[model samples]
Target: MKITRILNKIDRRFHPSHIYALQPDHDLLRENRTYREAKDIVLLSYPRSGNTWLRRLLANSILEAQQYPSSIQSDIPFETVVPSIYTQSIKPPCLHRYDEVCHRIVKSHEHRDARKHKTVYLFRNPVDTLVSWHHFVSNSPSLLQQFPWVVDLSIDEFCLNAVDGWAKHIQQTRHYKDILLVEYEHLFQYPHQMLANILDFCRIPRSNIDLDQIIDNQSIRKLKSVTHSQELRKGGVGHGEVELRPSTVTELRQYQQMLNVAWKPQVERSLMTAM
Candidate 1:
């Protein structure tokens, strides 16, 4: 038993998945200095929760608004447009064409440091989030190269381990004075209105950019063709209920109940009914 426990400890110590694990507050600023330096706006979400899609959309729109020649704006490297903690450790030079908001928007999956910046929190139903996250982590080439163990995890095991982080993220960032809550489903159902809301929240002028053109440019089909990215998946809702196990659903619901208790006054936005 002792030897087995020691082996388990060693396995976890060297696990690549620890890259996504929440860091202690003291180490967070040092480890995620790019995130700490982000100005005005930060886009926050748990992994696989539409953060990438939204970031690309915003970046493209900003470039268009600035009237960047189509050639320059055609392939907006999202990591460059919005300094991401996951992608860039040193701050990349800000693209010159777009205004200050473009430089200020940063993307992050972790939660603890969000309160320091005005945040746009994107959340999805926990069931769908886990299902999508499982697919992303298991299939991502970079993660698999170093830690093939991820592909071996059953969906149940993955969801069970990951269930708490979603709620914990909400708990930490919900009350910040400058936060905007964006539900992922709303992006699908009401793309125009949602985009406008986010632009307004981030203080980007909507008049200069054609919202319709930006949305079309950022559509999943066009983005996939242009970037050949595997990260963009089938992005509509309800996959969680269809893909996850019954036990996993129940566990996720329990977490939803906790989320409800956390934001009971905002009953209309409750996950209990939303999911």
Candidate 2:
């Protein structure tokens, strides 16, 4: 009761927009069991780890299976329904109710609750990730406007943040226990069979989405080539391989040496175990 009064006082003291600012209207997440009751799946991944394409494929599958009436985008729209989701929004927005959809699969780059439902963590080698990310951010003119500094920094400078500092945001999905780590190479190499493993694990049935049709689409086919977007860049699996000149690698190796202290091992072990 005292805590509630204090919280209320804090709420009353600040501007509602500031107090909640971009937050959804949920008094207490304690009662929000949507993510908990999810008999479905959360398609979790770092930005540009083929999550968009995966979601597309999943949407096509659901459509083909005839299990759903709308696109996968419609089947699960988290920003619209979930509380405090403040990333990018979907155009021709997806919308749904938990009980109504046959299965709801969410694509989120957000942090996960270790206590909640299943997760699929898709990743790529960091160099490849940076390459794809450069294209992704540059191509979206709006994002380009929002984050102008991204353009100012070269890949090496940018990676200092991705690798040097807050790298955990991308690397660790933190404590979600049911993560299935899928590397980008394997996904490209075996889209159908890999997707099958994901579906089967989630208990979703195999989809009738023409495995060939979706794969055959030219855009989908071309996604493999980072060069496809030259203005953005065309870095690949081992781009960093070349970028790390002998001196750079030596200096960078020291940074890792510093990071490889007593506490770091335990932390990495814990993160990998969760993944």
Best model per lDDT = 1
lDDT for model 1, please. Answer: 0.66
Residue-wise lDDT of candidate 1 within 1-275, one digit each (tens)? 01112123223432222654433332533555643554647888877788888887787667766775333236566566665665554333543345564546777776555767888888887888888877776766665665566666677776766666667667777568777778787786767778887887788877778777777777766766656554677666887787777867877878877776656455334333333
Clashes of each: 0, 0
Clashing pairs in 2: none
Model 2 Cα RMSD, Å? Answer: 10.9
| Deviation (Å) of 206 in candidate 2 | 1.5
lDDT (C-alpha, whole model) for all candidates: 0.66, 0.48
Worst 10 residues of 2 by lDDT: 1-10
lDDT of 1 at 245: 79
